[model samples]
Target chain A: MSNPFQIPEQEQHELDQLGAELRDAMPEVSLSEDFHEHLAAKIENSWSIRSAFQNNRMIRMAAGLLVMTLAAAPVAAWVGIWPQQKKNPPAIGFEIPEEVNVDESGGALGDSEDNQVTGPNDEFEAVEWSPQRRVALERYNRLVTAVASYELHGQDMELARFEGFSDQSAWASASEESLWLEFARRCAQADLSPLSAELVARCTLMLAAPLDRNASKQQRAAYAAWAWLLEGEQAKAADLQMNWPSAPFLTQN
Target chain B: MSPSSDDLLTRFAAGDPAAFDELVASLGPRLKGYFLRQGAQSSTAEDLVQNVFVRLLQNASRYQASGRLDAFCLRIARNLWIDHRRRGGRVFSSEEAFDRADPRPGPVQEADSGDRAVHLRSALDHLDADTRELLELAVLQQLPYREVSVILEIPVGTVKSRVYYSLRKLREQLHNLGPQEDLS
Candidate 1:
């Protein structure tokens, strides 16, 4: 009896013949050594850049940052600084300092009293506060703590960003003051600079009151306060602010 | 097959640029010819080959020599081609397209050296891109119906029938072209 599943030998022969024909028809192409030389050169050009990015140490650091950012909340909770869950969102009871005295005096954190902060060529003043400014400072504190807590996990940086650290909504609804402060804090803690410095400067300006009132005086205070915060030099910042030739932009609430 | 392409790849990853060079040199011409036969202009074929190497460079660290290098390389080429088509429609003339479409087209075309290359290439132009790719992989690649099924992400049996159906269509197209040049 003939096999049931077997393809007829004749049909198989035709297939083999066709397969052979197609194989023979395939074209032969060769690469010139010139191409190889060019490729080698290109690789050499890209080598350093790739090596810089692929440095095992940097990759490990980035990976560590990612893990930290993702695990921050849990870690923070474990350390007893943050809440375990958001069953009850905390009420907005944070205080905004009236004039962030940037003069060189206070605690290990820095002096809070002398307040005579000044700016370039006496153009900008030291410390001045507004309702909006207060919120910003509080937000900055929260994000700082968040990042510090995150760093404990040793995760990658990009992954941290992916896991909602970069989500605008996390800070968007925050009072403009809070948002600016948080933005400042993020800049400060970031591994890189330029953008952070600019953001800090912008945050100070946005919180400044209408120019007509203290006008020249207010500018000096804003700059002094900004300079102090960035350098972690509070006493001098405060001293510069106190020397301002006009009234403060903020009043204690 | 050969030692796992992945093993070769891992060696390349261990700073053996020579290994990478050899890999590229060995695969380069065939890949270029594969694209060219499918109707890719020489420049287009060159671009595709270059892109494959560029990708190899970028993902060298991720290359797993345990897997089939041919499959991995083919997968990369296939993805690039698919993306190219998605981004800018079809790239090759139908014959060249058919010739370039299969991961194993070089062999397929080689096997059927007679009038089929010209006739099939021409006839292939009449079919949709997907059908042409399916037929090329099945008939030319001599890929088991199952492998074709896996590569194209389709049912196994579908490959055989599709291959059979596409060949029939190609033959019909050849017939329609009249008894001009014999693809004997």
Candidate 2:
């Protein structure tokens, strides 16, 4: 393999120039003047309540540290009690993760006073995700694990085309026009009487999305191998895995 | 993906209203634009920007920034996007019908003038999700290749070459659309 980084000087110069043009061509996104003021006001009004339910422990930890400091101050000043001068701005005392305040609508939830808290964890229970989303995530993880661990699932291709497919839709849209679709069609109709028997049924419901009807040959084989693994037949999956073409699935791309 | 001054973030964490305004002014729009480029809707992009501000309000970006504040912020935006994907994924609920047009009303909405930027955007939409993201970070976000490499967790060389190929592909798509524009 030739060295990728060692571009000739002429090409490197062209690339550098191209880079500047690309930057200039891509116009910058400018916000309205009021946007900053409005967002600042909104954060000031709502995020404290948003933070209270975000995480209970961080506040408790901060409070505990404060109490420890107060107690130690008296001990150190026992001989001559003195008051400590306050800093210009009081410490906020807690840090929040970037996503802590957001809900699906992309805003803080619970506008009513109920979201307000005198102390962290004092008011409402801060459930980040509801029960339904939690279960869906869990099932998705299981399917990813099953598919990813399959010996035959070694290709580096991505099936990210299905941006908006759900289990129900996948099942509804299943057709026998192609092998992967046929696999999905069968899986969609899966009966759950036995765990092994339901492997096909779980295929669409569990994975991000089933293979498309027009998926490449390797895509179909990849799905078939996952079905085999989901049914506990690793050897069969491995055998089928060998026939995959140069590319693989499950990469970020 | 916006440039946030670590110093301003530190002041904001300490509850300075001026710093808060400055940070929001500087970071909010660009961050929202980044989200929009990554395929989020207008409302969703606004929400994503607000969420980043909320996190910044809680502490100094200084805590995370080792001199590369933009990288630090972009990493947060990326994680929020991943979380949004999982929560809003198709399993438990259905997505709004996927619209081919961006809903934000601005220079991007000019559908009739044969705007070159519009053509560029349409061409960009033709690429796959990952490739689009790579180009968005490396080019649109204006982050250095090394910074983008760290955020995307890929080699700097690979990032540069991929950006080259992606732009080449995008340029071909653009040429197919019309004749006046040249990304070369």
Candidate 3:
């Protein structure tokens, strides 16, 4: 390959073997182990960057959607149709089957001072400090109120029965002194029956498991390599591919 | 190049993260090594490679796949390298970045891939940046003259002549490094 500058730059020899020798001598290089971690972060950012380039297209498409939405707004408003944003919490309500008898016997043996749910420092306030636990307690309290109102008797009450609700194992595995378990015990010790309180606790404690709707047990990890990033809203948010699947439901918000 | 490597662009364009992953895993070393071959430090090479992927993703929809995945990546990598130089590549401090960027013993020295190629690496390091880049494009990547022309943004004739000169320079440098068994 060196015939060009040979004459112009004094005496020189052609050594085409250098390419093959370099190939033979240099081993194929390996990437750093954190290459994928860096790549994933870049890909996520690229999704946002790709969108910026098509902001014109997005604006046009959004305008078209807005016109159609405006046309249907009056009829939709009269009929009481409301589109829920993905970030909004689900609008779920269930009728409670039985009434809370509320053990008002002035201080039954089961209603010991230590048995009630309370903040870490305040034993009197029946409120939980953790937002997640508060959600559980709120749901539990709302169900008790619904049962007492006796107003709604026979709605689809699926939650009342908690049929097909997984996470029984999670609830069962909790230590006896778990705060939720103690709260459930308090309910059971109240004039409320064992079965109903157990059902309520089982239905609610599932939310605290730190599981994503899309996650599964690893079973085993490939210490050598990482799996691909899941597709959908993540892939689509990039605005590059249209065939990615829609994200499955239940983002906790 | 196997069809599997060729399809990194195709699969990535279709939004396959695994394909994107495979593309990075396959092409990342080439890019980082290219920067290193051109005398970039470990952190700079890593940052350049990262920019290449981000650029590829940004242009995935518009980039016409020409059945050359390495060329596609190298094109971005070369451009980023230019930009990186213009910005006056930041001085890297802290050997910590060095230890992290390379798991092997000191840069590419202890790459378990075997064979230090110490003389050749040292010889390549001695070459000027432009000479090393020309060698990287023509000799190392072995890209066709036309692809090399486009990536370097030079005429094919210029590529041919410069690569010849670069080869002569590298051959001379290796000669000066003296009778290393590997090269001899």
Q: Which number leads on lDDT?
A: 2
- TM-score for model 2? 0.45
Candidate 3 Cα deviation (angstroms), residue B142: 1.6
- What is the DockQ ranking, best to worst? 3, 2, 1
**Shift of residue B87 alpha carbon in model 3, Å:** 2.0
Q: Give the TM-score of chain A, superposed on the true chain A, for all candidates in the order listed.
A: 0.24, 0.22, 0.18
- Interface RMSD, every prediction, one decimal place: 4.9, 4.4, 3.4
- DockQ for every model, please: 0.13, 0.14, 0.22
Candidate 2: tens digits of C-alpha lDDT, residues B84-153: 8889832110011113123344443554666666566666767778887887788777788898898889
Please provide, for model 2 over A1-253, each residue's C-alpha lDDT reduced to its tens digit, 9 standing for 90 to 100: 7676667666566656654555554445665456666666667776564466344568767877999999988888863543222212112222222322322343331222243223245365554554323323333333334333322332323321222233443544443223243333222222111222233354534334755667655465545544443432332332322322332222221
lDDT for B148 (candidate 1):
70
B1-184 in candidate 1: lDDT tens per residue? 2544566577777888677777877778766655665556665666677777777777666765545565556567777776766777446674454444444455345436655456545555677777767765666545567667777887977777676566656656767854555434
lDDT of each residue in A44-106, candidate 1, tens digit only: 666554555564668778877988998997876677754333223222233423333222232
When summed lDDT is taken over every stretch of 10 residues in candidate 2 chain B, the lowest stretch is B91-100
**Sliding window of 10 residues with minimal summed lDDT for model 1 chain A:** A244-253
* Per-residue alpha-carbon lDDT of candidate 3 for residues A1-253, written as tens digits (9 for 90 to 100): 7755345433223345676666555545567678678767776766663356453577767777989999888978766644322223222232222342322333332112343445545545554233323333344443243233222222223223322214544445443224222332222222222233443344334333433434432111110001101111222122221111121121222
Candidate ordering by lDDT (highest first):
2, 3, 1
Per-prediction TM-score: 0.47, 0.45, 0.47
- The residue ranges of model 1 lying beyond 4 angstroms of the native Cα positions read A1-7, A32-34, A41-61, A66-253, B1-7, B37-39, B94-117, B141-146, B180-184
